[model samples]
Target: MKRVLVADDASFMRQMIRDIIEPEGYEVVGEASDGVEVVEKFQELNPDVVMMDIVMPKRSGIDAVKSIVEKFPGSKVVMCSALGQEALVMEAIQAGAKDFIVKPFKPDSVVSTLGKVLEKDD
Candidate 1:
């Protein structure tokens, strides 16, 4: 099973993601509520993928992505963003996020995106 690390400041969002992915055979290895915790948990858990919110506290998700990718070139990070944050999403992609899912997530899209990202070669 693929292991995922979920990072979102909102508790509900984190739980929502867990509810969506767990039944798909993905194990949620960890959760982080802030950018700094995201990076720390990522390094500690080394999950197969990271679902990171773009506008996190302590450090933006874009910055965290850069840090993780710099340290672990093969890191698979999928950014989470709200609507109208296209520019930030693009920046996150440039920062090395594998893909992105907009907020108010569609369950199918979330699962498919995670599947596709996991399928790619590191």
Candidate 2:
């Protein structure tokens, strides 16, 4: 199974994502509640993909993505943003995230987007 690192300041969001992806066969290897923890967890867990929230505490997800991509060029990051954060979403893609999902996630879209991110060549 593909391993995933879930990063979100909201515990409820993390739990919801875990619930959605776990049953779809993705192994949620670790979770991080802040941008700093996201990087730390990514290094420690070395997960196949990271589901990162854009508006995180300590550091922004875009910054975390930049750091992670600099350290691990092959890192696959998927940014999670709110409905109106179009600019931030684009910034995240430029920061090396493979894809993104808007907040209040739909299970099917999440799964499909993640699948595409995983399928892309590094």
Best candidate according to lDDT: 1
Candidate 2 lDDT by residue in tens digits, 1-122: 99999999999999999999999999999999999999999999999999999999999999999999999999999999999999999999999999999888999999999999999886
Give the backbone clash total of model 2. 0
Worst 10 residues of 2 by lDDT: 113-122
Candidate 2 residue 91 C-alpha distance from true site, Å: 0.6
Q: Model 1 segments beyond 4 Å from truth?
A: none
Model 2 residue runs over 4 Å out of place are none
lDDT (tens digit, per residue) of candidate 1 on 1-122: 99999999999999999999999999999999999999999989999999999998999999999999999999999999999999999999999999999989999999999999999997
The CA lDDT of each predicted structure is 0.97, 0.96
lDDT computed for candidate 1: 0.97
